[model samples]
Target chain A: MERVVTINLNGNAWQLDEAAYDALRAYLGAAEAGLKDNPDRAEILSDLEQAIADKCSVVLGPRKSVVSAGEMQAILKEMGPVTDSEGFAEGAAPKPPVDVEKRLYRLRQGAWFAGVCSGIGAFFKIDPTIVRVIFVIAALITQGAALLVYLVMMFVVPSAETSEEWAAAHGLPFNAQEIIDTAKKRFGEVAENQNRMWKSAQKPPREPKVNAFVSPVQKPAAGYGARMFAGVVASVCALAEAVIGLGVIFVVWSLFTTGAVLGVEAPDAWPLWGVIIGVVVASAFVTWPLRAARRAAFGALGYDAAGSEAAFSFFAFIFTVGGVWYAFQYWPAARDVIEPIWLWFRAIIAPGGF
Target chain B: MNPDEKFAPLRKGLLEFAILKVISGPAVYAADILARLQGTDFATQEGTLYPLLSRLRRDELVDYEWQESQAGPPRKYYRLTEMGRAHLDDLQAYWRGLNQTLDNLGTFGGA
Candidate 1:
């Protein structure tokens, strides 16, 4: 049985199947978009909803209480192309079309797996093979941490479905027919591969059959050695990210412990509150930038950044000011606490301390 | 150009006049107007009609009053305003002149 959703339209409650609801929502969205320039947009939208509700009531009876997907499709079709016939005034100046901004979308064409690397390559104007190679290296260095990251990315990043999305992914202007053809070709290849797999699965297991199925997938464009090197590099970068993460945690712990020790030693002189505040703020200054950098990196890897850098930067600025203020006011006291810790840290890292 | 494409703009231009005429005599619900226009050249969808009606209201050419409907929510009973009637008269005059010109210009013997 199909799932049904209850929707309130113009003070009437109507039950519609899930597909019908989705279609209705999309149709309304398109209508809204088309009415962007209209002054009484809300009033017209409500009127349209009322009309739709009346239509639904007329169709619904005892046997067919809920609107099916086919009925919803037909209803929307009856609504026609949601555009004003007398939209533009002849004397009015023509407004320039809004520019389409570049956005990150995973490329499906020439993709080995989920097109994550290809997406990243498109975003950065680099070769997809290079991205693949780097990912491999990172996975090796971080002991599969990079692989985990890739898996997460595959799920997170949206694949380019439309020609406009494909164009946006490549930071190009919308060229409809050509981009559509390319996307169709990519999907065709995928379908062909799936068909081959299905055919092979029906046959008895054989080495040559498996080879035949796999041969089409492998591209001869990138060298085997290059991919290996990329794997090493990707692993190394992943390792670096992990190390930096660990380093920040350690630093935070050490700062807090040192503040506690100093408070017990000289509670009055130490200004324990000031030291704690300073440490917290200063540590945030470091971590916030790191987080922003990570977001930028993700953006490069074809993930929507959601304009998070501004928020990160704002906090970073506030913390930096606070940190600097504390450093000036309590420099001597802070130095006294940190000097011993510095010596101890040096001694551990480089025995026979300088 | 295809006949449909060539006449689309003309039909659109005349739609407001046609609507004004439809409601000139009596306050008509939107669906009633659509029903009247069905199977005619000026036939359109709710998507197009609502916005056009709203624009007419904004221009003070048409006004609607809330009328409770037995079927669903309250409907907008639309009627042409005094200004809309005046505008319709001017448009009809212009249309008559165009028709006369077309009839007189028919059968061009020379290029």
Candidate 2:
């Protein structure tokens, strides 16, 4: 007999075989590690859970109860990998482009405001100052159509906020330091011109104060700070979603259990079967949702949330039925406890209010 | 666009103007919005549509409500807010003015 462990996922209870549970846990841990620094980490994680639940529910039919290892793997594959691949790290060497994936991004450090022209320059592999000059000339000649287009572009295209994002935008592996170097490369000529002007004054050869304007080391905090801020916002939004989901589940649970409480007809001599029936009724209502939520939680996180919900539901049902059967078979002790509770409920619930 | 890539700005006000125009009518879900955008130049743009919708919502031009669905979990149904309608009106007028300007570009005078 396989060991089935009950787990609460997204506030819903689910049963998983011990092996499946271990694998799912590992996958989720990887997802956390991979998305640890992502700005939309919370949103992506929530969406993932929802996706998993949907897929699992679809996978679990009338007969299937436990999610097998194969099903769990398939679910993750469909949702997309959460773990970062080996050799994919910060500042890794840029992979040689066998096929070009062109993407545009505004340079954060050297931009004269919105970095749109600089992004355009990077895309065309031209000097950004030349691109800025062209835009100025275009604005002058094209009756501000250039300005309107620029504004439109600012709203339409998203800015690349991180080296990983920059890489993804260009369909390349993330090489954070390389992209930073490229951004600095664009400003090299302008900086050199400024240096020449400074040197022509024939003053002492001072420290290369270019470090004051454009330091390669200063890039980390700005990139990370923005990501942290976005992550916080995402976490807040996710907390709100969780609160709402929990609230709904709580209401559903209470409604079922309380309704079952009213099912006892005779308060004075409470039949053990009546209490058992109430338990069975409550359990059915509780079990399906728990099963569904489990499937989703797993499926969303890369494990399809199905199969196991069935196994758990079956066990919960069997236990309830067996419990009621035992209580009815030996009704004397149960009646003592159930009798007072029945009396209180019957007294509280008014005549016609169900 | 590359030779193999057919993704157009489809009708290219980047679909924001058209999106608000559609939402200005009935409130709809993501699937409904996709359906409305279907057969237009913006068809097959699942990637672009979500970000555009997100930006529209972030700008407070649109809002969403969670509506329970019989088949799956509740879905977020999107609708235009009062601000969205006003923005749409401004955009429409600006579009008209741009069109008139383009028409008069035959004259050899610069603005």
Candidate 3:
């Protein structure tokens, strides 16, 4: 006599012979293992089992009898492709995937120092004891500095919580996976949205080939013209200074030579133009040093040399030479003819000058 | 029919149907269903029932509603949708065809 065992499946009872039961049990166990890591495994398995049970009932009929191995195999075959068996129902609306957020916590229960190890272990689904042992070894190697780091972490790191406020404070998400997915989706959506918006907002693209060539030439030419204009302005200013210096020298020379020859006292008061020439000369001397310093500063700040120092030096030299030449032209006229009398008077007052 | 035989098909059919059917309606509370099916041979453990219910729901033939139970935590109720009913109709038709073929084969030599 063949022995039979009764089992209930999908809220239904079934009386299966030992062979059938063993076959099903093995099948289900294997299926379960295969689906262990599947997100929808639970749902898929449930549906498949129901379909199997239903098929079995129809095939076996409602009578107590020993089911032969042949019959069992036939039923399994008629069940029509277990491999392609619909795991999930067709047209089951796709649900947005859910994300589970996990937290790290320092457990008060099993802590040696700051409980950081215990908390991290809990968060990562690991053994707290192992974490603690690792920390102990780390502390020994670091010479107790690990203790200070742990204390700082304890004070700095906030406890993980599901609340939005807590997550925000800790720079985490209440639902970390959900938030990340949503953010990624949103970014994609925004890019698409922007494209759509721009499509509507913008005018259609126009052919620029006709105008492009002219634009390139115009731009460069405008820049070149601006530089030339600036150079001309600088040169004109230098020329004006040189002319003014020459004019002052002529006036001073005429006044000093005429005044000395007539025995009239050369004007004790220097003309304002002389003072102007002196100032211009002093400015010329200072400008080169100042500009070199500026160029060095700019080079240090990573600007390429574009003859900025050369331009400054050239302007300074022009002004200096003009001033000195004008000064020399008037120097002989300004000399006193009664130098012997002046020297005797200077000697009595100060030996060095005499 | 013997009581065992008479009720056997009905029991089998109903249970199989219920598992798929419950998923169609609302979330079927596992515990409650267990209690309801208890005295009958249909009673099953939570582990077995839950996994099956999940499968039906996954297939989309049946959907589940998670209703808060006053007695305990939220319970999943299963319900049949239009799709599940259509599937059942197809299955019934297939069963009839199979039965006719079997009857014809059995009587083939005699006729």
Tens digit of lDDT per residue, candidate 2, span A93-115? Answer: 21332333567665543667556
Candidates' DockQ values?
0.30, 0.02, 0.04
Q: Which lDDT values do the candidates have, in the order given?
A: 0.61, 0.51, 0.47
Instruction: Please give, for residues A28-69, the per-residue lDDT of candidate 3 as tens digits.
Output: 444454445556664655555555665565566556344544
- Between candidates 1 and 3, name the one with more favorable DockQ: 1
Residue A203 lDDT (model 2): 22
The segments of candidate 3 whose C-alpha lies over 4 angstroms from its true place after superposition are: A1-90, A93-113, A161-354, B1-91, B98-111
For model 3, report DockQ. 0.04
- Tens digit of per-residue lDDT, candidate 2, span B1-111: 673244332244336777887788878876677678788765523323444565577689999998999987787788988899899999999989888898888877833
Better of 1 and 2 by TM-score: 1
Q: What is the DockQ of candidate 1?
A: 0.30
Best by lDDT: 1
lDDT of 2: 0.51
lDDT of 2 at A259: 33
Candidate 1, residues A1-354, lDDT tens digits: the string is 345677767556788875566556655555566676777766776788787777787789988899976677677667664565344333222122223455656666678876889999988889999999999999788766676677545434655643345655776422223323443444344235432211221222212111111122112222223333433333333334444444444454555666444234424565756655655577567656555555544343323343233322433343444443445456986556456666778999999877
Q: Could you say which candidate leads in DockQ?
A: 1
lDDT of 3 at A225: 30
